[model samples]
Target chain A: MENFEPVIVAFCCHYCAYTAADMAGTQRLTYPSNVKIIRVPCSCKVDALHLVKAFEKGADGVYVAGCLKGDCHFNNGNDRAASRVAYVKKYLEELGIESERLAMFRMSAGMGFQFAQTAKDMTEKIRELGPSPINVAKAQLKGEAA
Target chain B: MITAERKPLEEIIACVAPFRKVLLVGCNECVTVCAAGGRKEVGLLASGLHMALLQQGKSVEIREHTLERQCDPEYVEELNSLIDGADAVLSMACGCGVQTIAGRYKDKPVFPAVNTKFMGASERQGVWAERCQGCGNCLLGQTGGICPIARCAKRLMNGPCGGSTKGSCEIDPDTDCAWQLIWDRLKALGLTENYVEMIPAKDWRTSIGNGPRKIIREDLAE
Candidate 1:
């Protein structure tokens, strides 16, 4: 597992987290490239299906970044997204995948440092958890085939 | 409508463990309203099963479908072409929907993914409570639109049954006493006279006490 490089999918809300990520870019803040940002109109738009599909499609970790509390442009989209993340986390546990691999973070439109820091923290967490079980199984299957 | 909840992941995994290809069927009827077996649930369960099976080193091909109404023969017929490719069928509908698919395709192994809870009404968003028991004879008119058979724990016709305390049933404080609700409704409508009108003993034959029941209409019959 020494060479393991985790692939993290970060679902960023368009009005807040996405803009924060842009701020991180302009500020020259460097976060792990392991995290790939998928901009969504609102975190509420990120369905449970999308979270599970990320793991299904080989994401080692996934996290949703939305507006700060009460700052959602749609008024409670972040709250909805937070609950959805909690729900999907429970499902992940039921699937035998570690729930820590999924998370929800809140940030305002100007928190560029917060965005970069979150990406770094999540990457570290997933790195510590190693590759997700699905990836390990796929690798095992591939190894057997080879 | 009939309400249901999905069976545990362990139970579902065990049922489809031997199959390589599974047809995960969902219904758009009661189960959907109950948030149990709808298109959204089908996607969640399918993805869950995939990861769970994959973790055990078993990759499964799960084809997901949500029928317009699984209990109807016409809606179940839509799976006719897709059935050939699947080794087994996993229905996320109530028992009626499961049986519909099972009855239509005698050759395929059909399994239920949800436990049919009861015929109930949604109390609110994400909350459902049993409201009816399908007792052949309904006494709602006499009880001021409340059913004693289904709501009362003891099914008492004339009751507040010393078990009722502060408008809640003795069995659970959270459960509202059916008789108490009936009295309140009757009093509000100024029909308190119905409360003392001695209800006769109910005939058990009208219920499922005798056997399975069915209704036939001559005009509707071909």
Candidate 2:
């Protein structure tokens, strides 16, 4: 019901998006606390399995935040992550999960506002989508009304 | 190496939709090298199915197992202890592996997760091209080692068929005319005389025309 709070997982690249998240903290920008950030070596390190596993572990939404195109610290890490995120999005749709639950974004360490904006946007979108189907199933399995 | 491609995800998911528990078997031989049914792929698929089935509230127990070679009985025997634990087996091997597993356990159902593609060689990384037809005939010596049966758009014996232009096949611009390759090969070997000689009609008895074919060597029989 209206009390539902969506869970979101964000895989942020250490060189860019992760640093941006730290910047947002220093700037005192407020974003949904439910969006948990996992700092990865590079956006490319965020594999398709990790995204799906997040849902399996009860996350309602997942996002991969990498450096802007051609700005990857490792010279194409963000490019690779962008495509991998696309692949996972299609894979999730086929698996019966809403494609809106998974996403990818590009940002720089200087874009603290953008990082906060992405967090707020993802939280809003996932809240509208309600809790993930996996979470609903898990709740039902425990004989509780979701 | 034998090549295969993973079957569409929906089809594979549907095949085990009836089962509450399933065993996922991957082969380490050809499928692994081809990036189709390898151990890593098995893990990817198993986790995916687990997540999907969980969302449906279907408590499906999916287990993962990888064999050195699914086509070999010795390796397949490894599944003997685990087979009974699952309702069905989903094989991520080629057709031969699927059949081998099915034959080993006649009582259990075996489903294929990949479609066997061909007897081919890797053209490059992640790219495969057919190079052998296994016509029960070895004619590579005559065609400058390029297989006409497999490479030719039309399995022509004495050809170019006049449809070839600039050494490319008429069927597709990317396809090289097999006869052009044969000519280039024969010329390089100074065997132009052999090119003009008739190859004669192939004996159909040695091929699939004689039903299934096999090599029965009594000397090597166990």
Candidate 3:
């Protein structure tokens, strides 16, 4: 029995991921609605603070969707996003949070099907991993016993 | 820029033991620029400390605070109320800021969260290279902006040491030979004449020697 319906945050870059999502909607590609999308100008603009804050806010998983490498509307934005993602993953492991809680994906604007697949895959992965510890801790604080 | 790196979370956690109420101090200057002891690092360090303590079944009140510049007394004073309830303070600044905390709060135990490396600059993102020895001398004009004292494996003043091989330092092949870097930089800038100038032995007297160093600018003081 699936117990946890994971709340996942998908940070979609306005340049690509957001456009890709629009395409997915137009294409009527079915993806899990568990993922909530936040639009940012560039993936490089996403900082470590944003990733940690999402988890603190009870996101079971966080994913950053940026343009394909070298195709960032803002030059090098995807590269910078890649670095931030890697750094935050290490940081999450260090913070006693499973680093897999954070993930990054690269796709062109035309890859609406791929975007849907990514969302579906990430939601399933989080389901397998179970609720994030931060969320569990919050629930306990709210007088709920695990 | 001063060279610095984050202390392993294990080491930092070990230092904070036996204290329940603790203040985590992050510096906004060198440590921040180095990504070792900045505000963001303060959060990361605080979270790690909290997780470590929780895992051990120990309750710790880890308070996070960052100063504009920990080395300055004014910034240290800003932490007065934030540290009032804490049993101990963990400083994520360089050695200078650590001493400042100790000097300011004589009653509390102040610990360091980063190893003060050397005076250096960021070679690239996530890469810091030691550039200055704090020898109380500036010799950038002579070295073509490549600091031999810090870059050279041997700190050779004149030229590349015999240990240099194929433009790489013998100590580590991945590291560019310091003299080679200097020569390339000078050639690029058409300043090879600067390399001909002899650099004298670093004088120990002018640096952190003869006791704790102090810089008092009477004009600026007013």
Candidate 4:
């Protein structure tokens, strides 16, 4: 049987994390290509619904990388995003999905190393957790013979 | 600025136990602003119900619909098509909206997903504070805009009970002394003379006690 490659959705802030991700590319940092990046104007723009939609769309792991504390492009944007991420984490737990699947990180636009570390750490953690339990049940419900 | 919170998931599930095809209806008015029932809450409740039904091995066709204001007839009229497809409606609107939905759709069973608590405002974020008893009498002109009917531990119209100490109520230390607040505000506005005005016991007949109060605009009704 082929190994399940976990799908990861990384919401990268347009101003900082996205640029840092680009910098990681330019610096030739090697990380798993399974991480799909979505750019938003600010991390605060990512609401609880967006996180739920990501999970519904089959993301095994999700992360919101924003500016460091007090460095939000929009004042307190990262703070708002952090609170929402925490709130969504609780909802995920209530939904029987592991809260670790959702993560919030802070990084400067210059921290390509930190970005790479986050990617490696999250991939390895999700790998250890195995395929999401909800996904397993969902595949069975549809009778696709996974 | 009415404050509201969602009813527990188990309670909501129990209310819709008989329905197979359930439409989880949500209101985007007071409930929405308070984060109890809105488009976002509709999604949460719908997912919750789906999971619950799935666990019971009972398949429920779940759908979600939110109206701009469920209490108003115009927005509820927009629900005709969605309501037609569902076996029952689980309304997240307040008490008034629930009754309105039932009245509007005589044939369908409408269930309330939220227990309407009170006519109150937010004291702080996610904290709802009751401010009005709907006494039908304007007492704020005398009490410095604070309603003792709702705020006081004992609904003393004349003055504070003996439990008040250091400008806080003894019933709960966290609460501010209602009469103290009234006195301070009255003093600030140079309106202490209003406190001396001996107001009689409130006439509650004009309020909800007499049942189903109605206001008809005679000139505009035609």
Best by TM-score: 1
Candidate 3, which segments miss by more than 4 Å at Cα?
A137-146, B51-59, B137-146, B181-203, B207-222
lDDT of each residue in B72-172, candidate 3, tens digit only = 99889998888779999999999999999999999999999999998877778778877788667767678888778778888888988888889999999
Please identify model 1 stretches exceeding 4 Å from their true place: none
- iRMS per model, in Å, is 0.7, 1.7, 3.1, 2.8
The candidate 4 chain A region of ten consecutive residues with least summed lDDT is A137-146
- Candidate 3 TM-score over all chains jointly: 0.85
Candidate 1: clashing pairs of residues: none
Give the per-residue lDDT of model 1 (tens digit) for B124-206: 87789999999899899999999998999999999989999999999999999999999999999999999999889988888
DockQ scores for all the models shown? 0.87, 0.51, 0.26, 0.26
Per-residue lDDT for B14-103 in model 4, tens only? 777777888888888998977888899888777756655554444678788899989888789988888888889888889888888999
**A66, model 4: CA deviation in Å?**
1.5
The TM-scores, one per candidate, come to 0.96, 0.86, 0.85, 0.89
* Candidate 2 residue lDDT tens string, B1-222: 899988877898889889988999999999999988999778778877877777666777889999999998889999989999989999999998999999999989999999999899998866888888788889998889988888888899888787999999999988889999999999999988978888889887787789988778999867
After aligning candidate 1 to the native by TM-score, how far in Å is the CA of A132 from where it should be? 0.3
Better of 1 and 2 by lDDT: 1
lDDT of each: 0.95, 0.89, 0.86, 0.83
lDDT of 4 at B118: 76
Best-fitting candidate, scored by DockQ: 1
Fraction of native contacts under 8 Å reproduced by each candidate: 0.93, 0.57, 0.17, 0.07
CA shift at B168, candidate 1, in angstroms?
Answer: 2.1
